[model samples]
Target: MSQQARIDVISGAYGRANRKIEFPKNASGKHESMSDIFGTNVFSIKKMAKSLPKPVFENFRQQLKGGHTLDKVTADAIAHAAKVWALEHNATHFTHWFQPLNDTTAEKHDSFLSLKTTFDNGLAEISALETFSGSELCQSEPDASSFPSGGMRTTFEARGYTVWDTKSPMFIQDGPHGTRVLYVPSVFISYNGEALDEKTVLLRSSSVISKAALDILNLIEPASEDHPRAQNIYTTLGTEQEYFLVDRGLYALRPDLKTTGRTLIGSLPARHQQLEDHYFGKIPTRVLAAMSEVELELAKLGVPIKTRHNEVAPCQFEAAPIFEEAMLAVDHNLITMDVMHRVAHKYKLKCLFHEKPFKGVNGSGKHCNWSLSTDRGENLLSPSSTPETNYRFLLFLVAVLKGVMDHGDLLRTTAASSSNDHRLGAQEAPPAIISVFLGSELTEVLDAIEENRAVDRAVAGTTTTQMRVQGTTLDLKVATLPKLNRDMTDRNRTSPFAFTGNKFEFRAVGSKQSPAFPVTVLNSAVASALLEIKEDLLKQMGDKAVASEEDILAVIRKYITLTKKVRFEGDNYAEEWVKEAEKRGLPNIVKSPEAFKRILAPNNAEMLTRLGVFTQAELESRFHIMNEKYAKEIIIEAQTLWGLLVQHVLPAAFSYRRELSESAAALKQIGAEAAPEMKWLAQLSPLCSDLEDISEELDQLLNEQAPIEDPEKAAEHACYKISPAIEKARELCDKVERLVADKYWPLPKYHEMFSTL
Candidate 1:
C-alpha cells in the first residue's frame, strides 16, 4: 500500500472509534436489579423445580451433586424439563457444547423441530413438532476425525460422542437476529470411550482427588457412629481473566493482529504502561460500556462474575469470577471469554485474549486461584487462628507442596504454548520455573514444623502485629497468624504458584487457555501426593486402629523436608533465584518444546495413570497434540510476520524512501537545502535493507522446516530456528516502523491503536 492509502486507513479508524457507541439491550430496555438479572438465561434449580416432578427433581439433584450416572427415566425427565424451560425463553434449537482437544469450546447445533409421519385417514403425512429426547440430550455424535486426535482417530473413524455433563448447568446462548440456543455442557470422547477432550480428564482428576482427600480425612480423623464424615471432596477455581481491548477498525487494518492474535511487528509507544498509571486507573468510557454489558450477559448465564479493573498495561483489563467447583468454573470461564468477545464487538471494540498481544508491555494471564473443599463446607487449605495447631491443614498444605515438587516440570507444561512463550520469563509475568510461594508467616510455621519445634509466634515481645494504613491503625492481629491478608507480606506476583490466604494461585496459566488442563494436572498430582502421605502414616501406625498425633506430625515433617526445594518465598524473577533454583536441583524448563516433551516422563505418566486420571494412550496422544499445536502456531506467526513485511512494511518503506529521494532532488534542483530529507533517507535505508535481508532468511528457514515429518522435531525446529528468526524480523520491523513516517507506516501505530479507543 502507498503512504497516502495508509494514512487514509488510519484516519478512517480514528473516525470509526470516535463515533458514538450505541449500547445493546435485551428485551427489557434497561438492566434490572442484580438479583433480578442474575441467572435469567440459565436453567437453574428453580427452573428445574418448576418444570419437573418433585421426586424426579430431587433424584436428579442428588445425581448431579454426587456425579453419578443418570438413569434413563431421570434423563428423559430432565431433558423434557430443559426443553420446556428453553422454549419458554424463546429457544428454538439446542447444542451439545464441549471443549475439544484444542483449548477452545466447540458446538454443533440441532433444531428442536422433529419431523414425524402420522397417518391421517390412512394417509401418511409429515408434520414438524418441537421435541428433545433423552437420547438426544444424553449423547451427540460429531466428527472426531476432523479434530486433533494425535493418531487416536483416522479420517475413516469419524464417530465421536458428547455426553451431557450433569454437574455443569445448561444455559441459553443468544445469537444474531434473536436466535437463542440451549447449550448443554458435555464431554467429548472417541467411539471407544478413550478420553478425547479436556473435560473427561478433568472429571476423572476431580473424582480421584476427591476419593484421595476423603481417604486422608478418614485417616487423620476417624469417623465413628457419633460423627459421620462427608462422602466426597472437590477442588474449586476462580479464574482471573486478563485481556486487552483495541478499536475493531484498527484491528481490522492490522494484518498481523488479524492473523496471529498478536502484533507481530510494532514499535512500543512513547509511553506504554511505563508510568504504571493505567493500573487501577479510571477506565475509559467505551471500555467500561463494553465491560458492563459483558458482566450483565455473564450474570444472566450464572457466571458469578465479581470483579473488574484496569491492569498494569494500557488497554489491558481484568475480570474475575467467584470460586466454584473446578468443572463448573472451567465451563463458566469459557463462557465468560465468549461473552466478553461478543459484547466487545457490540461496542465496536476487539477484545484480545492473547497472552502477549503487544510487545514491551505487561502480558495477560489467567491466574487460576485454586483450592480444595469438602462436602461439609470445610476449606482444606484454610489455616485457622493457630496454623501450628491445625495439623489437618498442615497435612493438606504439605500434599500441595509435594504435588508441585514432584510434578513441577509437568505443571510448567500446562501453560506451554507458542503464544505464551513470549509472555513467560518476561518482566511482568512469572518465569517458566514452577515454584510455590508461601508467605513469610507460613514459611516460618513450616520450618518450625519440619524441625519438630514450636512456632515462635511472638515477634518483638508481642504476638500481634499492628499495621498503619494512612494514619488508621487497623488491628490485624486475629490470633497466631494475624489474619493473613491476601498478600501476607510483600505481594509475590513473580511466583508461578503462590498461596494467597485460603487458595493457591496458579498464575502461570495463559489467559486464552482453558483451566481444565492445568487444574487436572494439579488435582491429579495432589491426589497422588495425598495418597502417598496416607500410606506413610498408615505404615507408621502399623496395626494400630488409630494413629498418634506424633506419627502424623512425623509424616508431615518428612514431606516438608522432602519437598523443601520447590518452596521459594523470594522474588522469582530475580537473576539470583534462577542460579539458586539450579543449585537446589529444580527443573527450570523454559522452552515449551522441552516442557511438552516431559509430559510423558516416567514419573508423570505413572502418577497420572496410577491415579486413573489419564490412560497411557490419552497421555501419549496429548504429548503429540501439544507439540503439533506449538509448531503450527509458531509457523503461522512466522508466516504472518513475513507476509506483513513483504506485502505491507517493505512496500511502504520503499515508497516513502522514493518520495523522500524525489523531494530532496527537487529541493536540490531549486537551489535549496534538503538536509532533513537526506537525514530521513540515511536513517531509513539501513533499517529497510536489514529487514529485507532478515525476511529472506525467515523465508528460507520456513522452506527448510517444511519437510520435517515428526511433530516433536518440527516443534524443536520452530522453537529454536523459526522463533528466533521471527524475533529478529520483529526487531528490524520495529526499527523500520519507527523510521518510517506515521502516514507511511503500513500498520496502525501502537500509540494510535491504543489511544484511539
Candidate 2:
C-alpha cells in the first residue's frame, strides 16, 4: 500500500468522531428518561413483587434472601412470571448464562415456543406453543465436551447441568444479539455435580465467609456498642473497570491487536500519558460518545454505573459502579465489559481491555473495592467511635492482614494470567509482592494497638482509645469544583491491596480478568484466617469457650503482632520495598506460571477443600486448566510475533537496507562522494541481518518440543524460554522499525496511535 493509502485509513477512522449514533433500545418503545428505562429489562425484586402474588412473592423473597432451596410451587410461579415478562419485552429465547472455567460466560439459547401435540382432528400433527416450565427454568442440560474441564468429563460423556441461581434476578438483554436473550444467571456443573465454573467456587466461598462471620458475631454479646448481632453478613464489591479504545480501522490493520489483544512489536510511544495530562482530563469527543452509549445500555439492565473519567494512560478510561453483593457485582462487571465492547464498536472503535496494549505507558487495572456489610447496613471495615465496634473492626482488619500474610501466594495465584504478567510490577500497577496499605492514619492506630500504647484521648484515663481517623478535606482552589472531602490519609496507587478509607481496593487485578477467582481466594483466605483467630482465642480463653472483652483485646493484640509484616506503609513500587518484602518473607513470584504453582500447594489445597470451596480433585483440575491456558496464550503471542517479524518486519528492514545499498553504489557509479551512503549502508544492512537472525532464534525456541503431557512443564517452557525469545525478537524488530523508512514500515507506530487518540 502507498503512504497516502495508510494516511487515508487513519483519517477515515478519525472521521467517525464527527458522526453521532443512537443508543441501543428495546422494541417495546423508545426510552425518554433514565427513570423510564432503568430496570425495565431486569426481572428485579421490584418486578417480582409486582408480578407475583403477595404470599408467593414474600415466600420466594425469603428463599432468595435466606439462600434456601426454592419449592416447585415457587419455581413454577416465578418461571411463569419470567416467561410472560420476557415475551412482553419481545424476547423469543432464554439461556442459562454461566461462567465456565475459561473466565468467560457461555450460553445456549432455547426458544420459549416449544412444539407440542394437540390431536385436534385425530391426525398426527405438531403445534407450536409457548412451554417454558419450572423444570426448564430450574435446570438445563448443555453439552460439556466443548468446555475446559481438565478431564472431569470425557469428550463422549457430554452431559452438564445448569441450575438457576435465584438470588441473581433474571434480566432481559439489550442490543441486537442481546435483545432476544432472557439471560438467567446460573451455575454450571458436570453430570456427577462436579463444579465446572468460577461461580460454583465463588458461591461456596461466599457461604464459608458468611458462616464464619456469623460464628464470630454469635460469639460476641448481642446489642453491644449500640449494634445488634447480625443475622447475616454479605460481601460487597464496587468494581472499577479500566480500558483503552483505539479506532477499529487501526485495530483491523494491526494483526497483533486482533490476535493477542496487544501490540506485538512497537516502539515505546513518545507522547503516552507522559505529562500525566490525560489522568482525569477532558473526555475526548469520540470516547464520550462511546461512554454515553455504554451508560444508556447498562442503565436499562440495572447496573449502577456511578463514575466515568479519563484514566492515566492515553486512549484509556475507567467506569465504576456502586457496591453490590459480590456475586451480582461479578456478573455486572462481566456484562459491563461486554456492553462496553459493543458500544465501542458501534462508534467505530475497539475497546482494548488488554493490560498492556502499549509498552511505554500506564497499563489498565480493575481495582476491586471490597467490603463486608451486615443486614442492618454496617460496613465491617469502617472504624467506629464506640469501644466494642472499634475493637470488632480492628479484629476483622487484623484477620485480613493475617490472611494476606499466610496466603499472599494464593491470592496472586488467583490473579495469575499471561496477559497480567505484562502489567504487574510496573507502570502504575502493583508489584508481584502482595501487601496491604493501611494508610498513615490507620498505620498509627495499628501501631498503638501493637505496642499496647494508651491513646491520648483515652476517655478520661479509661482504657478505651478512640480509633476514629478524621476525614481529610481537599480544598483545591477551583471555582466550579466543590471543596472535596477525602479519606483520612492519601491514596496509595502502588499497593496491590490498599485500604482506601473504608474498603480495600485490590488494584493489581488485570482489566480483562474475571473477579470471581480473586474474590473467592480473598474471601476463603479471610475465612480461614478468621477461623484460626477464633481457635486461638478459644485456646486462650479455654479450649472451647468464648473470650471476654479483655481476652478478646489480648487475642487481637497477639494477631496484630503476628501479622504486622503484611502491612506496608511505604511505597510498594520502590526497589527498597522489594528488598524489604523479601526480608519480610513475602512471596514475590512474578511469573504467572510459577505464581500459579502456589495454588496446588498442600496448605492452599487443605484450606480450600476444608472450607468446601473446592474438592481435592477440583483443585488439581483448576491448576491444570490455568497452567494450560497460560501456556497456550504464550504460544499464541510467540507465534503472532513470529508471523509479523518474518513476513512484515524482516521485509521492511530488507527494503530499507536495499535502498541504502543501491544509493551507496549509485553514488559510487556517478563518481560522487559516497562516504555518507556507505556509512548509512554499513549501519542499515547489519541491523536487518540481525533482525532475521533473532527471528530464526525465536522460531527455534518456539519449535522445541517439551513434555506436552505435563501441563506444568509445558507452561514452564513457554514462560522460561519461549517468552524470552519472543521478547528478544520484539526487541530486534523494534530496532529494525527505527531503521526502516516511515513509508516502508508496515505496522502502526506508537506515536501515530498515541498522538491521534
Candidate 3:
C-alpha cells in the first residue's frame, strides 16, 4: 500500500475508535440561575457579601482591594461565608492550593465535617467561626524538608505553612469518586516567615510592577482634560502552550517517558516532520476528540482557550488564549495543564509538555506573549500614529527597552530549568542569550531620536504591499501592514525575547513550566525601569518652567542611549553574535545556578526590596529554591538513566548477543561459510562494549552521590558532572536501539510513540 493509503487507513481506524468514547456536554445550558451559578462552586465576593454581616463584608473587601491585613474578626466572618459556600457546592473538604519551591502546585486537603451534638438531636455541624478564624486561613503544616529548599530547611525542619492569598479567588474543584472540595490559592512559607513557594514571590513581584507602572503613567500623562484620574496599569500575559500527544500504551512502555516526563533515549523516526504535512494539518479524529474534551473542561473554569492547531513537529500541537491579567493568567494556565492530562487520558492518549520529549526533533516551548495595559483599556506597548508625536507612548516604550537592557540576566534566570537546558539553542527554540527584536522601523526611530533628528510622520504611516493573484483574479488591496509598528520586525526564532505586534513574546519559557515565574520576573524588572524613568523625569521637571513635553522626550532619548547595548536585531544563535554580546559586556549566564546568582546580587536585592516586590528574606529564599530544584531534577534524571541501563538495556543486549552466538554455531554445523553471520556478530560486539561502558559510567555516577554542602556548588555539580553522564548513557542506548532486534528491544521505539498517533 502507498504511504497515503496507510495513513488514511490508520486515520479511519482512529476515527472509528473515538466513536466509543463518551465526552461531556457543555454545562452552561443545563445549569439555570446564571447569577447564582456564576460562582456557585466558588467562595466569591458576592457569596461572602451575602453570607457575612454588612460591616464584616465591607471590611473584608477593603482588605482584599487595598492589600491590607485582615483582622481576627474580619477573618472569622469571611471564613464563615466560605464554609457555607463550600457546603452548598457539596464540598466536604478544603485545601490550601499553593505553588511550592518545586515549581509545581501542591495541596493538602482537610475535611470540613466535624462531629458535634446539637441541643435537641445528635448531628454534625461545621461552625462559621471555626471556618472563618485567622488560624484556619493563616496556615497548614506540610513536609517542607522533602521539597527543594536550597539548604533553607533541613530534614529535621519539616514544618511548612500555607497562608490564604486574598488576591486570587477561591474555587471548588469537582472530581470523580465523590471527591468535591474548595481550594484557596495561597502562599507557602517556612516557620520563620521565609517564602517556600513561587506564589509568595510572584505576588510580591506583581505589586512591584503595578506600583512602578502607575508611577510612569502618572508622570507621562498626569491628570488632564483627555485623561481623568490616573488609572491603574497591569501586566498582561497570554501563554501559548505547545505539547505532544501519543498513545498511552506506547508512552507507558518507555521508562524514561514515565519517570522524567521526556524520553531520555530515542532515535528520530524516518518520516518525522519531513513533509511539513503535520504543521496546521487536518486534526486526527482521536486528537480532535481529546482536544474537544480539554477545551470544554477549560472553558467551564473560564480558561478562554482561543486557538488550537498542529505544530511543526508531528504529534505536537499548540493551544493559545487571549491575554489576561498576569497573575490570573498564570493561575488559569496551571489549571489548564492539569485538565489537559485528565482529558488526554480519556482518549487513551498522554500529553507530553516537556521541553524536549524526543532527541533530534523539534522540542516544545511555551511562548509567553506579554504586554502592559491600563485599566482604561489602553495597551501601553503599542506604537501610536506619530513616532515623533505620541509623547506618552514613546516614554513607555523606552522604559521597557531600558528595563530589558539593564536586567537581561534576571530575565534569563526566569526561564532557566534542567529540561529547558536541553531545548534552548536547538531546533526553533531560542538561544540562552537574551536580546530584543524591535524590527527595522522601531530601530530607525530610536536611532533618529538618539541623533536628535525629527522622524518623518509620513515614513511611520507608510505600508508594505504584496501583489496577490487568486484564481486568475489580481487584487491590489491595502492590507495595512505592521508598518512602523514593532510587529513589522521580522521574527527571530533564535532570539529569546522578541517584540510581536502590541506585546513582547518571551520565547524562552519551557513547555512544562508554570508561566508564573517568568512573568513575575518580567513584571518586576519592567517596574524597576519605570520607577527609574519616573524619578529622573520628576527630577528634571521639578522646576515648573522646564516642565514641558520636550523634557519628557529628552529624558526618553537619554534612556535610548543608555539601553542601546541590550538591543540586538541580529542572529542571537550565531557564534559571531555571542562574541559581539560578550564584547558589549552582557552577562551570558547559561546554567540555572549561574543565572540564579543574579537574583541575589546587591543591586537586584536592593531594587526589588525597595519596590516592595520582594522582602530581602523572600528574595534570598527564591534564589535557594531555584538552585535546589535544578539540582534535584538533574539527580532524578541521572538515577532514571541508571535504572534504564541496568534493567532494560543490559538485559536486552545480552539476549541479542546470545541469539547471535547461537546463529553462528548453527551456520557452521550446516557446513556453510558463516562470514555474513560472523560480520553481524562483529557489529553486535562493539554495541555490547558501548552498552557495558555506559552501564559502568551510570553506576559510578550513582555510587558517588556525595551531597554538596553549598547550594551554588551543588547546582553547578549537577549541570557539569551528572548531566554529561546522563547524555553519554543516552547516546549508547540510542545506538543499541537501532542495532538490537525489535522483538528483544524491551522498550517501545521513538517511531512507535511519535508516529503511531
Provide the lowest-lDDT 10-residue window in model 3: 465-474
Superposition error at 645 for model 3 (Å): 1.8
lDDT of 3 by residue, 284-375 (tens): 87898888777766654657788999998888999998789888888888887888888888777899999988887788999999998887
Count of clashes, each model: 0, 0, 3
lDDT of 2 by residue, 457-549 (tens): 332222324444454456698889987755466788888999976789888788998899999999999999989887776777774345677
Candidate 1 lDDT over residue span 1-757, tens digit each? 4446546655765665433433345577863666677888999888888889998888888887775668889889989989988999899999999999888999999999989999989999999899998999999999999998888999999999999988787999989999999999999999989878999999999999999999888887878787779788999999999999998877888888888899998899889888989999999888887888888788789999999999998899999999998999999999999999898888788999999999999999999999999888889998865676688999999999999999999999999998898899898889989999987777878888888786655421224433111112235766555543333344599999998878899999999999999999999999999999989999988987667888788898899899899999888999999999999988888899999977899999999999888989999899999999999999999899899989988988898899999999999999999999999999999988898899899999999889998999999999999999999999988888878777776677788777866
Q: Model 2: residues >4 Å from true position, as ranges?
A: 1-5, 17-31, 177-179, 223-228, 386-389, 456-467, 472-486, 540-547
Between which residue pairs do clashes occur in model 3?
76-132, 79-132, 439-489
TM-score of model 3 (CA atoms): 0.89
* lDDT computed for candidate 1: 0.88
Write the number of the candidate with greater TM-score, choosing between 1 and 3.
Answer: 1
The TM-score measured for candidate 1 stands at 0.94
Predicted structure 3: clash tally: 3
Clashing residue pairs in candidate 1 (N, C-alpha, C atoms within 3 angstroms):
none
lDDT-based ranking: 1, 2, 3
